[model samples]
Target: MAQRAERTERTERADAQRNREAVLAAADALFAASSSPHGVSMDDIAAAAGVGKGTLFRRFGDRSGLIAAVITSRLEPLRRTVREVQEATGSAPRQQVADLLDTALTFKIDNRNLMSAAEDAGISSPYQAQHYGWWHETLRTALDRVPGVHAPEFTAHALLAAIRADLVAHLLDERKMSPEELRSSLAAHLDNVLGAA
Candidate 1:
């Protein structure tokens, strides 16, 4: 009897994992195909994923929660890369700072829709989450190693704010800045921030 119950629990967990992946994939496709985040609805995601709407709610809580999950799923690879860079030895602090911000900026640019969905769902406050703190602390650590940067804590925050999701969307969607141009401009800005280091 106990073995049967254990098997049943394993099956349920497998089902849950499958459902979560299906939902994430559906959300990603829908967001990518839509011009705006507002166009995609929970019903749309549920239908595409072939899961009950209740399942999404149960697993992710609500619209913002679901969108956060989707965004987090997309961010995993970038996070892994950043972790490796953090763990790596002998990299210059200035280059580390640029690499971290550039990697983050590229993710925002590439996955603008995911971030847009977070904004549309009213989950756009970056500072409210541990994710934001992680970025800030990592950047501050690198900035601390640099010779000339003052107030590394505030410098980290300022640099992160510059590449924020809404700003990325505005620059790309409204002001018509190309990714290359934005990257170049950020590099120049970094040169100023790093101050000849």
Candidate 2:
């Protein structure tokens, strides 16, 4: 009887893990497909995942927690790329800074809906995010390496603000600017900020 109970516990753990993955996957798909991620709700996710709403709350604590988990999962690859850029050999500081901002801009443009949802859920400031510090420090470090760049930290913050999710969304969605046009403008802006190379 004890052995049977142990087997049942193991099965339950496995099932819980599967449910968590299903929930994340469903949330990701729903958010990506939605024009407005704020329209997605915990109940929608639970239903899509074939799990109870209570189970979602039990696993993720709350809606914001679940959204954070989904964003973290989606950002893992981008984080890896950022790390690689940081560790790459022989790239000039200006070039590295440009690369970093460009990478972040592309990510913001791609995931603006998820980011907008995060903001609508009351996570209004990127500084409140765990990953924000890493991004800031990475860009600040690159800026520091550049000889003529003044105020590395502030410049880093300013550059990040330029590519912020809401700003990107506003430019693309509201202002009707093309992504290519946005990219070109960012490149030109970076040239002005970095100043010759």
lDDT of 2 at 84: 79
Candidate 1: worst-modelled 10 consecutive residues by lDDT:
123-132
Compose the digit string of candidate 1's lDDT tens values, residues 27-57: 9999888777678999999999999999999
Cα-based lDDT for every prediction: 0.85, 0.86
Once fitted onto the true fold, the runs of candidate 1 whose alpha carbons sit more than 4 angstroms away are none
Model 2's TM-score against the true structure: 0.91
lDDT of model 2 at position 105: 84
lDDT of 2 by residue, 35-106 (tens): 886778999999999999999999998998888888888889988877876786678778888888888788
